[model samples]
Target: MAEHGRRRWRLVLTASPLQGHMSPMLHLATFLHSKGFSITMAHSDLNRPDPLNHPGLTFLPLRDNLSATADFAGAGQFLQTLNDNCRPHFQHHLVQIIDSQKEASASEKESIVVIHDNLMFFAGSVAADLGLPSIILRTSSASFFPAINIIPQLLEQGRFPVQGPNNQILDNEEIVSELHPIRYKDLPFLCTPIEQTLKTINMIITKKPPSAFLWNTFEFLEPTGLTHIRDHYQVPVFSVGPLHKIIPTHSTSFHKEDTSCISWLDKQAPRSVVYVSLGSLANVDEKISTEMAWGLANSNQPFLWVVRPGLVKGFEWFEFLPEDLVNQMKMRGLIVKWAPQKEVLAHSAVGGFWSHCGWNSTLESMFEGVPMLCQPFELDQKVNCRYLSDVWKIGVEIVAERGEIEDAIRKVLVGKEGEEMKQRAIEIQEKVKVAISHGGSSHNSLEAFVDYILSL
Candidate 1:
């Protein structure tokens, strides 16, 4: 109700306390705000966005009582801590938001909607208790979201908790559905105990179904997964993404991004440099770090490598690079604490990415049409690498050995096979550009999402 037919829709959004989760959530909020909706973002105190940095959007930090260091333990522990400690704070703030909306005058009163990241299951509960329309945003691919639903079936079939010597169960691929062909290795939390898997399953199932599902993936990228989710779920599913392409924003890194890498890339030949980064959370042990260093040096190709602090276990920063490897990297490679990833990907010199296959990095590389050398460490990274290598043919996965890493780099950077992979990536890039433009699938889906929120 508005005095002069003015729109007064307000959205409350919450994301899990992780860099990957927060980045996309911020982008979505920015997009909605641009579309004439007022936005309020509830975030964990750790890694909270500065409210001053984002005008017209209110930022509320929930007291989770956990330090930022909690993230280093891994995804399972971080998620468990959030669920255990953040619920009361989240609920209390949500009630306050609802009360504030109710207190407004009739014409100025806003129609409140809640959008929460899939990992923040508690937000959904609060939304339901308050009778607000809630939308669950799966920041990863549509494929990864449905996989969690079938964990119990996998457990019953003795396919989960991937037991036995060296986890032999992961070696065999089973068709979960006509849409999803998965191996045990692609499942997240595979190394964790069955109790952890059960807890995740229970958490997902116990939540009341949201009004709709929002995915940060395009239709062409995950057709079968999208189809399966749409057919199986009762709510409407919207696939409107490569979110970065749709709404380009500044660097959202918890650490500072070194833009000097762009200047370094300027000196390299077009498509001759490989960009390597393992993402925010994936850690490489000392041995693997050493192997990677030598492998990159041996590749003899120009590279821009981001060696973040705490990336190597039991060592500080770039201390992992050996003396000999440092000499080799002198002219051929540039190592920075962190690089502006999107800028690096878009640079002409960068041809392939050595990445952890985090969904954000995956989408960014694809959008920029750069081929990838995927070294997925955990979580949805494995599933995303499967799609990149097996489904899309835009990238290749690397084995942990130094020789394999060196070979993968050469294959992607200078080999004839890499040219064809680059072509495929370019095609995907064109399709993504079209999808985010006017009269495209993702654009229409986003409009539909807005319309649904208005109707509510």
Candidate 2:
């Protein structure tokens, strides 16, 4: 929406194509708009935010040149391609916008700040070339940077490939002293092939530093992470998060969110349904899906699950399940392509979240005071899962085995341990509530971020 008041400003923001990344960037834009700054969202065409969903904001789509039919490459190569294809187009469009703004009246033009996701670092260089201020929006956890920074030393110490399918490195080898509760095995860098992981990490590291780093994380949840990143980066760092709640924005979902589950949740008892969603990425095999279905059914708890198209590797939605089990699941659960996550989590019947532990999901679960069954698939998700299960003690690590999934679901939904974790979650959520209110850390940091932006 348009900025209100005399001193005006505008934010031209861009985000990675993934839903997890796009949601927070849009939330940031929405939140900043509330603070009297106009917003323009520049996005890749692959997952463009709908102009209808965001009434007052402008949507500038950059040519991603990604074929919908192209075979999917690994994360590293895919990101490299996105950057390469979008750079020249991004620069040209940015220059056009800058030149156009120069022709507008003072009130309409407003000062512009180019804010972009770390994965879209090309935007930062374009902004730098245009002599405009730029900021980095880290959509993942604050702990990510420091964890990746130590990889060189860990490699020198011969810690690479710590676990060889029969080793104990995954169990807990040398602890990362700087970011405690995270060991070598839990590093997000190892989530992909080593060469590719290094390729992506190198791309991230070599980008020019921005004026500031805005993290979608709060202080209480990652004090050490925020501390480490700020100290290491030596730039202004702001943790203004649960951004979806900060200003309560409209959805920027790349996929249409099925809201019918909310009504299904209405009939269940308070804290009775276990909501399972693996987010926009993470794919599981048929075996895992079958086991998960049996587990949710066996837990004897009503559940809601998001079975995204192609979520099962090489298969469609659980068509392979036997008719009887499918019938049982139909009796007790609701499955949608994608649920309105925040609404689902906030529902009174949702007691637990079976998640992929993506940072956005983690923060949403924590903010809603819902405990989790952690099944991190890749990237920073592993780091967040470790912190949730081992450090915060609010989540339980789960496997795809029917028995384990059943037990974990039951534990989170009804057991004493579940109660304890729920209490801690609620307690942490209370503090988080305070943090977003006036005179709190996130509130203060957000204010400082706004002030810093205005200072330019």
- Candidate 1: pairs in clash: none
> Per-residue alpha-carbon lDDT of model 2 for 247-310, expressed as tens digits?
8667877778888878888999999999999988788989899999999989999999999988
Off by over 4 Å in 2: 1-8, 100-110, 163-174
Query: What lDDT does candidate 1 reach at residue 114?
Result: 87
What is candidate 1's local distance difference test score? 0.82
Give the TM-score of each candidate.
0.94, 0.93
Candidates' C-alpha lDDT: 0.82, 0.84
Question: Mind giving the per-residue lDDT tens digits that candidate 1 earns over 410-447?
Answer: 99988888999999999999999899999888999998
| Candidate 1 RMSD to the correct structure | 2.3
Lowest lDDT 10-mer window, candidate 2?
1-10
- TM-score between candidate 1 and the true structure: 0.94
